[model samples]
Each structure stands twice: as structure tokens, then as C-alpha cells.
Target: MSHPVVILGTGLAGFTLAREFRKLDKETPLVLVSRDHGGFYSKPMLSNALAGNKTPASLVMKDSDKMSAELGAATIHKGRTVAGIDTAARVIELDGGERIAYRDLVFAVGADPIRLPIEGDAADTVLSVNDLDDYGRFSERLDGVTSVAVLGAGLIGCEFANDLLSRGISPTVIDLAPRVLPRLLPDAASERLRSKLAEAGASFRFNVSVSRVDRAGAGLKLTLSDGSVLDAGLVLSAVGLRPRTGLAAEAGVRVNRGIVTDRLLSASAPHTHALGDCAEVDGHTLPYVMPIMQQARALAATLAGNATPVVYPPMPVIVKTPACPTVVCPPALDASGAWTVELTDDGCDARFHSGDGQLLGFALLGAATKQRQALVSQVPGLLV
Candidate 1:
């Protein structure tokens, strides 16, 4: 009997690759292993679900059984943890000593939320919504909560702040950076989004970091580096995410910022591959949905004996802050360019240009977002 194609996660990347691969090759036996319940849901919806009147259970589109049948998987190992991988033997050992052989292996384990070290007794009470279970806990804690202190004014932080406003909860967003989305937007565009969110009942503390969190009454008190204190019903940390590379690294797979995979999404080990937030494909670690879609399609074809390479077009990220309509396609980190911003009455359009005047990237807010398609076409592909 032929060994099954085994996938080590049930997140978007893992399930997506399975669906894409099944479309091309149905006879191949497939097995999916997950650390959670193995439900199908859009992860990006977790942030704005509250405003959409969506509950944790409602967010899940399909359960493990439904997914198993839909994908025609031989077995769906829900709530199972992989102890280790024997790459040489093409087998994965589960925590309970059960082992499963695989014709090919994939790691789509995603990433973990970065937790900050804060001094105080209540520091452990801080919450981060990284998955469905985490969102359920956060939702349960929101009862009777009037305000929240959000750490990090990055993409997730800003979106949550805007979503919280819809539930009549005021959010005080604190970030070490001078402006919100400092990495994604230029100064003018960042200011535009800041002002819009501020107008929608969101507060901001720039250039300051949270030093401590202490229990204050039924809520929490956060002390900032600038010696300021903020009191709120809850504290949320949305600083950033780090790839889950330990499993792959321990298995002798090359690991850098993420599991190092070639352009073909193949790991150092034979018949082992990785993608999504857990993979640094060709030196690019993009934890976004679009890249994962591209990776899934390309990898699916490759697994189907096509040997296709993933091609990435300019994918602009649409910020989920209803308070402000914004889109951004940031330039490469190593790209040498300068931003030219035009601030309008209702919005701002900022573009990053190379020395030769080629459009490298752009940020569009409010009315300026209407030009998203036009501007996106001008920007070069991230990976071609």
C-alpha cells in the first residue's frame, strides 16, 4: 500500500493545499493532523468578527468531520500533537507514541503570538487572539467590558481598536513606534488613519511602551515607559507573530526567520515541504493570506508532478478598520526608495519610488483608495 500525503496542520495553509492538491490528484490518500479541533474558518475574520455580529462558533464554517469528508482525507487527527518527525524514515511520531508514515510531509503549523514581558501580578491576564480558541476566550472576557488597552499600533491592533468601537468599547492603543502601521504606511498615510480612528473613539499613545500591568479594581492598570498610567477593563497584546519553527528545526529542516524553503516550497529534507506563516519561501516570510494562496496553488501543482514555481503579483493589504478605508502594498525591506506623499482633504496617497522613478510600493487611504487598482499595477511583483 502507498503511504498517504500527510499534512501537519489544519490552518488555512494546510487545508488550502489539501483542497488544491485534491482537485488535481484525487486518488492520492491524504491525512491531516492538527493540534486543535480542525475546523475551517477564515482567520482574518477573527479581528472584525465582533463588528460583524459573529460569535466564535459562528466563525467556524465547518467542523473536523465535515472537513475530513470534504477533502476525502483518510484520517483527520484532531486535537493531536506531533511529538517529532523522523525525516529519514518519513514518519511522524505523535505525543502518545503513535507513529504515522507519509509518502510526503508538509508543515503548515502557522505562527505564535509574541508575548511581552511586563512586571506585575496581573501580567499573565493579558490576552491575544491568534486562533479560534483564543478568540472564544477573548469574546467571553468582553462581557461588561467598557474599555481595552491594546499594545502595539500595528495592523491587528488598529483593526481591533476599530472593531471594539462598534461594541461601544473605547480602545487606547499603545505602541513603541511613533505612528500606527509605521512599517506599512508612510508618515502622511499613517497620520490619516490615526486621525480617522481617533475620530471614531480610539485613543493612541505613540513612542511609549507598556512597562507593567497591575490589577486595578475589576480591571487592569498599565504603566507606560513614559510614566503614564492607563486603566481599562482588559489588556490585549498584538505586538507581532513569530513562526513556529521548532518542530521543523528539530527534524533537521533548515530554519531561519521561518522554516527555510526553496522557491518550490521544498524543505532541506527529501519529500518534506512547508508554506504559510511558518515558511520563509525564497527568503520572504509573508504571513498574509494572498501569499499562502499563491504558495498553495504552486505547491499543489508541484505535488501533482507539474514542478511549478509560485508567482507573486503586487498584493495590497486592505486594512479592516471601518473607521478608515486603507490599503497598502509595502516595498521590499531591502529596496532603496523614498516616499512621496500627497495629503488630500479627505485622505492621503503615498507612493514609494526608486531612484529611477519606478513605483516600488504605495499606501492609499479614504478617497485615495479608489486608485488602488491603478497604483497596484504600477508596482512590481514581489516574486516573479
Candidate 2:
């Protein structure tokens, strides 16, 4: 019997690649393995799910059985963890010592939330929502909670803060950065978003980090680096995410910040590939939806005997905070540019321009977001 093409995840990356591959070659046997329940859901929605009144169960669009029928997968191994990979033999060893041979192997393991070290006995009580299971736990903890302490001011942190406010719960957002989304938006645009969220009952504590978390009656008390204490019903950590690369590294596949892959999404090992948050494709580790979609399409074609290289267009990220509509397309990390911002009564149009007068990137807030399509056309593709 011929070995089946095996995917080791059920997240957006793995399922998307399977769907795209099936479109080109439906006859090939396909199999998927997921550590969780193998359900299909929009992970990005988790940050803003409260405002939409969505529960963890409601967020799942399809279960493993339904997905198996739709994708025509030979098997969908739900709640099974891959213990290790045997690259030389092209086989994966499950947690219980079960081995499965594969014609080709793909890693879409995604990323893990970064946990910060804090002093105090209640430090371990901080919550983070990285997947559906995490969201479920967070949702259950929200019962009778009127206030939450969010330990980040980045995209996910800000989105959750806004979501909390929409549900009439106050959120105190703490961050080490001076302003929100410091890495993604200009100072002016960041201030605009902060002001809007503040108006919606969101509190900000910038230039400070959470030093400790202690129990305070029925809630939690957080001590900041600035020697200030804040009390809240819950503490949430949204610091950031780190790509999961331990499995690839153990299997002797080249690993960097993520699982290193070439433009064709091929790992260093034969017949092995990776994509999505777990992959660093040609030195780029983009954890956004657009890049993953592009990678899935290209990798699917390559796996289907077409050998296509992935190309990326100018992709803009839309911030989910309804308090202030925002869109940002940050400039390249190594690009030399200065932001020129035009502040308006309701929003701001901030553009990063090169020294030679070229449009590099932009952050559009509120009404200025209407220029997204026009500006996107001007920005060059990330990879050609």
C-alpha cells in the first residue's frame, strides 16, 4: 500500500494546505493529526470573541468528522500528539510509541504564547488565549469578573481590551512600551487608538512591566515595575508568541526562529515541509493570515507536482478594535524610513516614507482607513 501524505496539525495552515492540495490532486491519500479536538475555527477571532458573544463551542465551524468528509481525508487523528519525527525513515512516532509512515510530511504546529516570569505565589494564575482550548478556559474564568489586567499593549492585548470594554468590563492594559502597538504604528496613530480605547473605559499603564502577581481577596493584585499596584478580577498575559520548532530541531531539520524552509516551503529534510507560524520561509516569519494563505497555495502546488515558489503581496493588517478602526502595513524591519503623520479630528493618516521619497508603509486610523486599497497598491511586494 502507498504511504499517505501526512499533516501534523489541524490549524489554519495544515487544513488550508490540505484543501488546496485536494483541489489539484484528489486521488492522493491524505491524513491529518491534531493534538487538540481537530476542529476548524478562526483563531484570530479569539481576541475579539467576547464582543461577538461567541463561545468556544460556537467558534468551531466544523469538527474532525465533518472535516474528514469535506476534505476526503483518509484519517483525521484527533487528540493525538506526535512524540518525535524520524526524518531518515520518513515516519512520525506518536506519544504512545505508534509509528506512521508517510510519503510526505508537513509541519503546521503553529506557535506558543510567551510566558513571562513573575514573582509571587499567584503568578501562575495569569491566563493566555492562544487556541480554542485556551479561549474556553478564559471564558469560564470571566464569570462575575468586572475588571481584568492585561499584560501587553500589542495587537492582541489591545483587541482583548476593547472586547472586554464592549462587554461592560473594565480593562487595565499594562505594557513595557511607551505606547500601544509601538512596533506596528507610529506614535501619533498609537496615541489615537489609546485615546479611543480610553474613552471606552480602558485604562493604560505604559513604560512599566508586571513584576508580580499576588492574591487579593477574590481577585488578583499586580505589582508593576514602577512600584504601583493594581487590583483586578483576572490577569491575562498577551505578551507575544514564539514559533514551535523543537520537533523540527529534534528531527534534524534546519531550525531558526522557526522551522526553516525555502521559497518552495521545503524543509532541509527530504519530502519534509512546513508553513504558517511554525515556518520561517526564506528568512521571513510572518504569522498573519495573508502570508499563511499565500504559503498554502504555493506549497499545495509544489506538493501537487507543480513546484511553485511562494510570492507575497503587500498585505495590510486590520486591527479589530471597534473603538478605533485601524489598519497598518509596517515597513520592512531593515528599511530606513521616517513616519510623516497627518492627524485629524477623528483619526490620523501616518505614512512611512523612504529617504528617496518612496512609500514604504502606513498606519491608517478611523476615517483614514479608506485609503487601504490605494496605499496597498503602491507598497511593493514583500517577496517576488
What residue runs in model 2 are displaced by over 4 Å at the alpha carbon? none
Candidate 2 residue 337 Cα shift, in angstroms, is 1.6
Cα RMSD (angstroms) for every candidate in the order listed: 0.9, 0.9
TM-score of every model? 0.99, 0.99
Which segments of model 1 are wrong by more than 4 Å?
A: none
Local accuracy of candidate 2 as per-residue lDDT tens digits, 256-374: 99999999999999999999999999999998999999999999999899999999989899899999999999998888979999998977999999999899999999999999999
Candidate 1 lDDT tens digits, 200-238: 999999999999999988989899999999999999999
TM-score of 2: 0.99
